[model samples]
Target: MTLLDFDSDRLAEFATQVRGDYEELKAKNLKLDLTRGKPSSEQLDVGEALLALPGEGDHKDADGADVRNYGNLKGIRDIRELWADVLGINPEYLVAGDASSLNIMFDLVSWSYAFGNNDSERAWKDEEKVRWICPVPGYDRHFTISEHFGFEMVSVPMLDDGPDLAAIRELVQDPQVKGMWAVPTFGNPTGITFSEEVCRELASMETAAPDFRIVWDNAYAVHTLTDEFPPIHDVVAFAEEAGNPNRFWAMSSTSKITLAGAGVSFFNSSKANLDWYLATAGVRGIGPNKVNQLAHARYFGDAEGVRAVMRKHAGSLAPKFTRVQEIMRERLGEYEVARWTEPEGGYFISLDVIDGTASRVVELAKEAGIALTGAGSSFPLKDDPNNRNIRLAPSLPPVEELEVAMDGVATCVLLAAVEKLGA
Candidate 1:
């Protein structure tokens, strides 16, 4: 039965039992972590072949540019063409970079704030007030970037298919609303891919801000937990067709597919936007690590080779995701005190507990020696109005450790829910 059906007496008894469970959990003194969505060691082993790639004397790119020396600020063609095909963008439009796409994202915003983008009438720093649209239960790092820029972050609901387009359309009516953040494919924690209709609307929608941009962080484009990768829509093409050619700054990476810390990153946009990026990027450094880029190209000979690597990732990851869902159902199903997303791809499972109790759940779990992503971390400024959401990262730990940690988490959830209800 659901907790709501319980009388005061039964509720008290249940709370006592859950308290006992919590005590036993604390007694175990377990040190388990579910805080970050890092790839497991086994998953990393899948890409061990990358370590020895591009053997000696393989420094020249397809264009015969010596990769060891610096010159191509736009990145080597070999890696760009490979990931361009994977991300469904033209090779010319894609710029391959170093390990972290997050760094590239930060640079984009930083440059725009200081010098503005190709279409900006004035640098963002000159604006009286800058604002950004952040979809709720989204990536914390994205919110961190927005917050760091001192932009007034406005939260919009992330629906099943995509961010609420109607709200976005309304928000864009204000010229200060410069852009929005989107993880179009297998989004960070939600695992929801934007539908074609949503993509069309976002690309074509009218905005008062002439320089409106979308940070399309497709981080998990191929990090699927299923057999087939989802179709990646060409949002840039949509924007071009809709007369908003500079609307999107799309990005992806090999971070999750291969080595998380040592992988190539990609950026794709209109020619004007790319030129703008290159102009500033040129001053920032001589060029990206082209030798590393060439190594990646050699690692994944073609697009299919990339998919083959992803299939290995799926093989290792799918079971962990499945086990998390199974444990959640087995433990929390009857209580009906929580619900969570069952994602087909992506590294997180978004868990929502009883209203006003998420923080308590996190606290209880911490006391029991389990670490969870902080309560309300999925929202901007570390705030969740209802205090009801928690992001669960099951990717880091092994299946056995994950199962144990999840069980402890389930106990914590029940204890927190009961305490909240009884009080």
Candidate 2:
């Protein structure tokens, strides 16, 4: 039975027992971190072959461009084609860059601030006020970018299918609303992909701002942890078909696929958006490290090569994710003080604890030296209005470590819930 149904005497007894367990955990002086969705050392080892890639005298791309030297500002064509095959977009639509897709996203925000996109009345910085819609229980870094630019961040709810489209439709009536962030496939914490209907509706929706842009950060497109995962629909095509071709700026990277810091990053969109982005981005550099790009291209010969790498990643990742779910189910299943996601792909599992107790649970976890992602990291401005969500990052730690940490988490969650009920 859930704590909500527990009689006063039973709840009090449970709370007292949990408090004792918490004390013993604190005395252990343990140290375990689950704060970031970083790849494990074993996962990193899978891509170690990339270090020796594009071996001696192998500096030329397929088009005969000298990768050792500077010139192709947009990126090497062959590499773009490889990524294009993965993203299901044309090679011409892709622009390969250095390792961080987050950096690419920030650059677009900066560019929009200074110059605006082709349709803007003026630079976003010059506007009286700029606002952006942020789907909550989302990637915190995405919210950080909007905050960095001084945009008023509107919090939208994230449903099982995706962000609430009806809410989005209502919010876009404000002309000051300039942009939004989306992690369309296997979203950071929630792990929900947008439905095809929602994608098309967003692509075609009329916005009060002529330059409304969607930063489509599809970071986990190929990361599948289950056999039954569905392929994501083509949002770029959906937008183009709706006659809003320039409304999107899609970004992806091999940061998780190959090496976190050494992999390739890419962006894709309609011709006008690409031209606008390049005209500004080209001034920032001669070209991305083509040597690195060539190394990745050779490392993954084609689309199938990329898929093979992700499978190896899943082999290591699935176990950790499974262990987290198992521990949560065993410890909290009967009490029902918390609920968590069983994501098919992606690096996080989102946990929603009893109302008003998530922060307390994190505080208790930290005292035990088991580091979890801070309470409310999934929301814009780090504010979980209900204060009920906690993001569990199981990828960074080994399974044995993750299991122990999750047990500690279960204790904290149960203790917090009982304490709240007693109050």
Candidate 3:
């Protein structure tokens, strides 16, 4: 029965049992962590061949450019061609960068603040106030970048198919609303892929700001847990057809596909946006690490090679995800005090406990030596308003440890709900 169905006395009795379970969990002194969506060692091992790539003076790229030296600010054609196919964009519009896509995103915001983008009337810094559309239960890191830029983040509801388009359409009527952030495919925390209709609207929608941009961070573009990959729409092309050629600053990386810190990063956009980025990025450095880019290019010979590796990742990750769901179902399903997403492609499961009880649940888990991503982490400024959303990352832990951690988490969720109800 659901916890709400229980009388005060029965609830109290059940709370006693849950408290006892929590006590046992605490006594175990587990050091399990479900904090971040990091790939497990087993998953990382699948890309171990990357370490030995482009070895023994094998540094010439497709155009015979010496990758050992630096000059191609647009990145090597070899790697760009590989990822362009994966990202569904033209190689000419794609700029291969260093390992971290986050860094590229940061630089884009910083440059936009300092100097205007391709179509900007003026630099963002000149604005009275810059506001950005943030879809929540979203990526905390994306929100972090917005906060770093002093942008007033406006929260929009992230729906099953994508962010609330009706709300986004209304919000963009303000000239102060400069940009929005989107994951588009297998979004962080929520794993919700934007439908083609949503993509088309985002591409075609009218906004008051001429320079309005969307930071399309497709981090989980190919990180699928199933045989079928989600359809990757060419939103850049959509924007072009809609006369908003500079609307999207698309980004993707091999960070999760290969070594987290050593994989290549990519940025795709219109020709004008690419030119603007290169003009500023030229000042940041001569170019990205061509050697590492070459290594990645040699490692994954083509788009299909990348897919083959992802299949191996799915083999390792699917079981852990399944275990998390099973444990949650077994332990907390009947209580009906919490709900979580069943993501098919991404690394995180967005969990919502009873309203106003998420923080308590996290605290209970921590005291039991299981670390969870802080409650409200999926919202802007770390504010959930309801204090109910929790991002559960089941990718980093093995199935055995994940099973234990998830059970403890379920116990904590139940305990927190009972405590809130009792009070």
Residue 109, model 3: Cα distance from true site in angstroms: 0.8
The alpha-carbon deviation from the true structure for residue 64 of candidate 3, after best TM-score superposition, in angstroms, is 0.7
Q: Residue-wise lDDT of candidate 2 within 1-423, one digit each (tens)?
A: 787888888878878889999998888788999999899999999999999989999999988988999778789987899989987788888899999999989998899899888889999999999999999889999999998989999989999888999899999999999999999888899988888888899999999999999999999999888654457667788898998888888999999988998889999888888888888877997789999999998999998898988989999999999999998999999888888888899989999999899999999999999998899988888999899999998998888888889999999998888888873
Give candidate 2 regions above 4 Å deviation: none
Model 2 / residue 172 / CA error / Å: 1.0
The CA lDDT of each predicted structure is 0.92, 0.90, 0.92
lDDT of 2 at 322: 91
Clash pairs for candidate 2:
none
Per-model TM-score on C-alpha atoms: 0.99, 0.98, 0.99
Q: What C-alpha lDDT, on a 0 to 100 scale, does residue 34 get in candidate 1?
A: 98
Instruction: Report clash pairs, candidate 1.
Output: none
Candidate with the larger lDDT of 1 and 2: 1
Quote the positional error of residue 74 for candidate 3 in Å: 0.6
